[model samples]
Target: MTRRILLFGATGYTGGLVARALLERGEVPVLVGRDRAALDRRAAEIRPSDPPYTMVLDVHDVGTLRRTISADDVIVTTVGPFHSHGRTVAEAAAEAGASYIDSAGEPPFIRWTFEKLGTRAANRGARILPGFGNEYVTGQLAGAWALERAAEMGVPHRLEIGYFSTGGSLCSLSRGTIASLAGSSLERSYTYRNGIRAERPGARSSSFRIGGRKYSGFSIGTTEHLTLPEVSPSLQELDVYLGWFGKASPLLATASLAGPLIRRLPGAKRVVSTVGARLGGFGKDGPESHERDRSGVLVSARVFSKSKHKLSEITLAGPNGYELTASLMAWAATVESHASTRSVHRRTGVLGAIQAYGLGVVRDTCLHLDVREVESAVVSA
Candidate 1:
């Protein structure tokens, strides 16, 4: 069977970028989406140098979707707030035996896939993984790499991840991302704590100084805590912190403190929905070249051994989150398309980014991004 790379939601902000990037990299992908006109226009734009193939089909049509996908194909999607619209696509992909990946950064959606669909996908011999976007992929890959480095010295037990997106004013985020926040505003998140899955009362926040610059960061909902523990056998704790909401980040703590009450209050839901709509909408384009150039993800990690020794300090610096996300997702698609059964261990059950593709592959693919690791020097406290 020939390996085919299929892309869904090709007209959206991230998906369009992914499609364009694919073309720029000399790849011709099969574009699928609900809008025939838009898909046609996008396909023409992406492949002006060549003809293109596209499918105009509603994702809600499960049978059609299933038939559209093939066992030797891979699908990368960006049409989300995934918790609501994502499951159907995932279902169809799994049913068709197509390996799947998405730009879903929401915790609820990611957890749903693992807790609810991981086994089913495994049963069908399908590989479906989520949160392969800028949200957690960077952290997951960083943590996995750090753990490997730490193991050379000693067995690592805890993985601490800090994701703080910073750009001066030109920071542009997608409407889908903002829509995701609005959809699950009051949702509580579980962090891997002391070898147990648990939730604290409020979103955790912290300050970090990397490269002589201090930044404020807070925890955001991600599936890393749930997925990482399975990959990191010796891991006793996992904390993934992010600051994507920009000025609205404090609301994470606010909701954590009184989410039930606030969610029940009048106009609160409408208010969040309205703001997210504006932030994610209003003729808003995804980050422009200048904006993307300025945009970056600064992820730092500290890995500790079970012996209470700090084993390593690692930093992963990368370019524009959305662009990088598209790059990473496209790379995964290429890798999975040609991946043989012998290369994949089905027992891991769908697998995290590091598990689905080996840590080495991820690191190598992301070589354009900087990953620096240094041995930790014990500081007497």
Candidate 2:
């Protein structure tokens, strides 16, 4: 079995961006998707590299997916609303002992990966990671930074990692993203409560006025609430919030009210979900680099000790969502590829970016994100 990466959903919007980033960096992955022509065109568009091996299959087509990968290969998937489509790919990768990574953000699905799929992947000698992209990595970096700073304190500690995305006025998402959020609205948001994975039902809200901007935060389901605890096991509490929604609180509140119905009535959900397709990447274009720069997330994490001491604070302004996701998947894939087989084999089971690559590499490799730590000034890595 040859060592390589099988990039699933290479034809989708975020997937295409990952493909280009990979190609631009003089790397290649076996592009996988349901559309053969689109995959071929994408392969052709990339710079000269190893002839791409393409696989066409639906997100749930695990039987066929198994035949396309090997133990030495790693699967990087972008085909999501992960709650609906992530399990199959994860299962197939675990069964085959093929390493796996995904751009999954939905908390329900991410919790499913770490709690349910972690053992499965490990049993088969595979290393699986969810939320390796925009949805969680930036937050993970902030958390990891705090932990490292506290480690510098040289004391026993119980800490907390709070994740919130600050701004995105010019930011917009694809129909796919909107649809995912709409679907996840019905699924129970999850977190590690009292050192255990627990379901956080209903919508959790946050209100804060910072940097001359008012934030009405929405807990729209994210993996960070779960994964960050594993990264820093001493972390006693974790809250993941979304202030980037800005004025959309009323609409989200309505969704919260309708969540019970969405779970029970399929038709009602269908009608509401049309908003996702309309508002997402359907007809509207995504933001460009400059536009994204003007509107990126401020991932702020405060580090505290068991005695309620504020040890240190970590802050990072990540790149645009789409670009951040693409860069992360590409960079993680590249890191896994260059790593020794023994190193990979030792990393079996679901892991976060901090656990998989460490904060040093995450900060170093994701150069596009600007990071600032307390008393540290602006450091590149």
Candidate 3:
């Protein structure tokens, strides 16, 4: 069956990689964007330029986008700042009866998107899976694996997810990421502790080491904390930290502290795009610099249960942060497409990619792509 996918933001960096990945996998999705010239350039690069189709329409032009994607087609949207475009795209997709997915950066945005659109999607049988990118999917999947192992051993309690990378940011972060950064007015952190969600002041001493390298990691904007309720309602506490191999610790630390302040600036939104574009790529120095982040996820959990078992570990490692993100987003679209076609009624309502796709499926795919599994183990009681 032909999977009719309407790809929004097809001309952007993440969009380009996702489109390429889709083409490589032998799928021709209808590319949609507001820029005719950029869309033309992207289409020319695809294997068969004339495979499907491309449309230049603003996402806010709900009338056009709504009618265009108003069908059973899957809507793969990479446009973000999600606070801005998320509702427009999600609402359009839901009304159109299209399965929706995107790479949202912040938790509040993810929460808002799902809360506002979740019911519509469920009612319409559409999948509104956000954070399908590196931010949450890989980490969440790894956490899921660790929790499953803990459950098997009868000691599941707390999950701590740490991301260490030899590569850089996974997907193409756009102006929206910059805007999110620029608009930050206060220092903040989210944690799920003992089955309760709480916000706290950004903590110091967020530094830790993995693989013998001293990496300084702090809580940046991520949904891992938000997803705990969905993944494991019984989770006692879930913490996610970002570790940088080298000097990035200082920049990351500064970003964490200043993010909220900068976000509140009057002109911050205008410069967010520029900052994100400049800071998007990885530095050539490798592993240490925030410029070129090497991708690695270390998930360690302390399980408190009826059994004597207490510790569980799982890691989903990969290379080429940007490339991997592109691959992941495309893969997510593929899963949603396939699931939609098969009428899989497993569950709906802001479902996670790994939960939607299953570990065996992701594990096999990772193996094929040579994304190694460094460790998947459980500490016995």
CA lDDT of 97 in candidate 1?
69
User: Which candidate's TM-score is highest?
Assistant: 1
Give the Cα-based TM-score of candidate 2 against the true structure: 0.85
lDDT, residue 81, model 1: 73
Model 1 misplacement above 4 A: 153-155, 168-171, 194-202, 245-252, 265-271, 281-283, 305-309, 341-348, 369-381
Give the per-residue lDDT digits (tens) of candidate 2, residues 1-381: 236988888877788888887776667788988888988887877644555777777877767777766678878898877877788888888788877889887777887887788887787877788888776888778777777787677442543333335445523666567777776676777544556444434356655444444455565445666566665666776656665566676456545866775678757656655666567755654555565565555566666677877787665665567787888888778766766666544667788877777778778876644434433244221
State the C-alpha lDDT per candidate.
0.72, 0.69, 0.62
The digit string of per-residue lDDT tens for model 3 on 271-305 reads 76545535543322112324324344343333445
lDDT score for residue 344 of model 1: 51
Better of 1 and 3 by TM-score: 1
lDDT score of residue 150 within candidate 3: 72
Query: How far off is residue 13 in model 1, in Å?
Result: 0.5
Looking at candidate 3, what is the lDDT of residue 127? 70
Compose the digit string of candidate 1's lDDT tens values, residues 233-253. 888877776655445555565
Error of 3 at 231 (Å): 4.4
lDDT value, residue 373 of candidate 1: 40
Per-residue lDDT value at 36 in model 3: 85
